[model samples]
Target: MGFELPDRSVLPRHPVIVGDEPRQSGSGAMFCHLYPANGQPTGEVAGAGAADVDAAVAAARAAQPAWRAMNGDARRDLLLRYAAVLKQHAQELAALETLGNGSPVMMAGYAPMVAAQRFEYYAGWADKLRGQTLSAWNNPAHNYVDYEPYGVVGAVIPWNGPVFAAAMLLAPVLAAGNCVVIKAPELAPYSVMRMGELFLEAGFPPGVVNMLAGGPEVGAAIVGHADVDKVAFIGSGGTARKVLQSAAENLTPCCLELGGKSAVIVFEDADLAQAGQMGLSGAISVSGQGCVNGTRVLVQRSIYDQYLAVMQQIAGHIPVGDPLDPGTVMGPVISEASVQRILGIVGKAREEGARVLTGGQRLDGEYADGFYLPLTIIADVDPASSLSRHEVFGPVLAVTPFDSEEEAIALANGTDYGLGAYIHTRDLRRAHSVANQMQAGMIHVNASGEGMQPFAPFGGMKQSGFGRLGGEQGLLEFLQTRNVWMNLKAPQ
Candidate 1:
């Protein structure tokens, strides 16, 4: 079976891009405008090239000294102000996010809330940024390490969760005192542009945070720009590879959060009803666009049919409509290309002999204009099938059976991606062992989803990309430690 798409009118609304902004996407509505690469906006997108990047970098360099000079309290206060401003504009922000990225308005609302919490979390950390104290190995002396921010960070965000991911990268980077030049993904640049207004209102100096809307050339230029100290990106592994190659030109440090095809495990002893709901929720949440979504479900063979029946029922009930509709549960994908990519994955699944239980066809006529693919459930997926291994980035779920705990572990850990994994079992000891054995950055026991927490580290262990994004560990991602040593006693 394959995925089905809804009719055109089910499409999400798009926000208008403010004047002179360079925009893309077949649907138009001006989602983004290209800014000057050097820090000035050329009337034409082409003219806003290298010189614009240079200008932006120069502006950032000039502003960074003063920005960094602010005491921790001042920085924290500014972030607190920013948080308040974001809260005040939550509705507007949520609407913009939905319109720009085709996410459900409800999920879009979560962005502002999460962003606010992230700000609050990092705000509290600003004044507490500390290094280490240690004894000198070879001398009667004490040594300490001081943490400092790297100047001029280049942030390259993706379209899936534009506002939320940008806020995630921005909060800690800024709170740590680094000036930023963001290259917002072309697909959803409007959301980022709107955010700049909030940052300015919150009193961040101009050039301290700059934004640009363009494609790979722009990202390459920003990454290789001589003045940039580091680069942060969230996107596909293919693009991540290119970004890394580009960043290497200047030896700039990079933080990457790439793609994943996470798995969910269901043992016979587990709760089938709840796990079924969780499986559907894990697969369809964000329309299956999240990196950590459990797209692959490994059910114990004894209950595979029962579990599949429940999942199919739940997936069939998911509402596919306008993202603006308060009652809508799932929305259109960000672009037509995304739809094509998703359908292409389905085609491959069929060729590879997977059984599509429901939603394997497109809903034509009315939904022709909307880029939406129906939630798809595939059963009897061959262990070696591409559908079980790759990220479809759509509302597609693959179910395969496992005969034993070891088999379940093998199936879940087979993917190159190590973002997250899910396990459900009544036996606590078995759950613990499985959790420890699963080859993923995060694991959910008896649960089918993962979420961000301020005190826990989040990142993958394999091809899913590197570095933590939350907790004290995540804060350190944006900081550089400097070691200082002195002899408290007489020098030997």
Candidate 2:
């Protein structure tokens, strides 16, 4: 039933599953979703309301002791086996993601694949969990610390990259010996359920990993649940603020992975071709839905026109069609609301005196139901406009010309966000200086975006979000430190 790509406008005649047991409900039973590939309604996902959250939490609370008692090696084995299961069902999982979210099929598949890799990466860290030692000057004794896990981790994921973000939280939370109750996003629940199936196959104790699916109520319930020790959330800054407020009641430690309006800077001495390619790819990947996307381009005034010409030519050709189509490089913007939001930003940019270089039209031809926005490029956009300072989350790249290194750095750091900033310069001193000046979690030197790697840390400094998600820091976020003091002095 899932293999066939239904038309975007019509609802599919199926239902997405809820639990490990093939307990199914009719379409729209739980979630209000359409096929992401075509922007049509698919089968309804069964919703797990308040009662479901309680049940899942109870299950997790009950199983926590035993699951926590298990050694890290055993957990590692289970995760490795789970990784294998994901690999085996990758095709099925990928198709589900593509259908549930409107991203290109290839792009949708990326989350599941990366999620599996993430699990494997954290699985290796299970046994490597460690603490530290601190010196106590006041007393003649050895002082140290131990890393420990909080009991039940509540994971609230966003629709943009449901599987990956969930895995990003879950992998480390589990590896740190914490049981988790994951609440899938209302907009994209299918992929989360698919992940649950993989976990079940990985042989995690039944209650150790539970999934609750529904809307805001369900997520709120999970985060506020008394038994849940920590909350890991990935969503908008507005939503994240509410989550933080909600979590405050219980003093639950919360990690918020929020939004961004990242910058990509181009200097005259750099490789223009590489800069253009990375700039276009960074802004357009995931249709500009990613939190770390390079939506703002700061080019040196000398080469601004040349860079625009190259960028315009390349942006014009980005494939926008059926996400399932192998040739498609860009897809719909996830929802109609997102499309409207992007359009509003474009209008605001024009009012602020930005020039539309190319692609400012809403595409309705070929795929009528799909919500595809043109690969838009706005030149000479005011740095003060929302398009330059806020996240549009669409295929729109705003370019602003800058003169000298100080202005480039000043403009890049002007926004409230500090997620990611990119710089391209052949001069080593200039690149290093620019990289240091930008106030962001990650700064890409001579590259438009940070290439995917398992080792590097990826997170923002300011409003982009608190806490790291990848690399050693990511794993550490899920872990807590405990000091252990040892005394060699003879008992007197």
Candidate 3:
């Protein structure tokens, strides 16, 4: 069967959403979207420009006071209702995600509910953010700290997982009583644009949430806006530098979530079957475009060959085809450029003496037009090679062998990016020791498929970018602290 796409009628026509209404871009610029499944024209939407970004920011600024002034219980109730609305339209949003981004329908289906869960999780936190009452050293004085919202937040999300990224930032931002302007990725803006509409339907104030669908210029404008109190960005580190440069002009605080070259370490005593399956899945899930994917695999030398055999068998059997097909386990990357880039990295790895155990080439025949690459495993990868050091952001796994537990830990911490690390081991003490030594923000032991939990902190370390995006830390990202002191002995 051929690839199937979602109905265009379900997509929003006007991508610039302000004050609870979807409207045309002020600049009248339009951008077309292509279906990654077949590289066919999906449709076009008006692209936001500097003017539209300014309008959205202005709207958010105007709405922030009222949003913040509302009682926390009221804000919590609205967020809870919004979560329900997201669940109600989960399938519709999932179809839009698969249509534009080429994630398999089965996997894409989880994003909406994941978003809903985030909202629900943060909803409980809405009324629960508390401040500290400090003991004063001076005579008869009361000292306390207050958490205040940043007033306005500008968020820039990438194309790979728009809905999830939107929820990741938006849930905590909104619950903390901040108004926001979200710059949806031009490559895949459908689901996020619809998300803006859902916010209004959930009875949020008119200007509380605004979304702009555009390219880099719009993102730049949002980051540089002096009125924007805070900025949250999720994308490549290169782009993050540009964002930082622009944000510096206004001295706006920023929270960035960038790319990773996460590592998966497997000890000899590990359940090789489980390690191979989950380790490969961690590297290739989301078509290997995830920022936190464990694409670099470090195995103990004794079981290195045995692990490669298991990985090769599993990778070869993984289904890679039309994203809409329920049976398809892997789908196309974001675009043709992504396919070329991933293939180029694989080609360079081979030149550096990395052996392609399975699936190093792009698929042909039925998937010729689409940007498809099967799950690739390259064994004998040199730890010092570019393949092991840089982020491929594709479904390609680079495996290197380590002689000891300490060697495995060194290899896992060898990269500049420290977003996530995975270790598969039978020994609990080793798991704890290695996990403590891993430089990444999040670590998984004997498991890789649990995914992001809403209750814990999610972020990276070092070059992977700073700032937490889940749990209480995420909520605090949009808030500022204020210290207050009052004299209790005034009457004396």
Q: Which of 1 and 3 is the better model by TM-score?
A: 3
Best by lDDT: 3
What would the per-residue lDDT of candidate 1 be over residues 1-492, giving only the tens digit for each residue?
A: 112222324222222111122222222112333111111121222213455567667878888898888888998988888888888888877876776667777778888877888888889988888778986886677799998899989888888788778888888898899988887676655567667667776777767787666666677788888899989888889989998888898898999888888889999998888888888875568788888889899999999888988888778788876677677788766666677887888888888888888776654554556676788898899878889988888888999999999999999999899999888889999999999998888888877654566667788879999987888888899999898888777745
What does the lDDT come to for candidate 3?
0.89
Model 2 gets an lDDT of: 0.78
Against the correct fold, how does model 2 do in TM-score?
0.93
Per-candidate RMSD, Å:
6.2, 3.1, 1.1
Clashes of each: 23, 16, 0
Ranking by lDDT: 3, 2, 1
> TM-score of predicted model 1?
0.89
lDDT of 1 at 67: 82
RMSD to native, candidate 2 = 3.1
| Per-model TM-score versus the true fold | 0.89, 0.93, 0.98
**Which structure is stronger by lDDT: 1 or 3?**
3
Please, what are the lDDT tens digits per residue for candidate 2 over residues 152-265?
888988887777787788888888888888876778777777677667666677788887667888888888888888888888898888888889889999888888888999
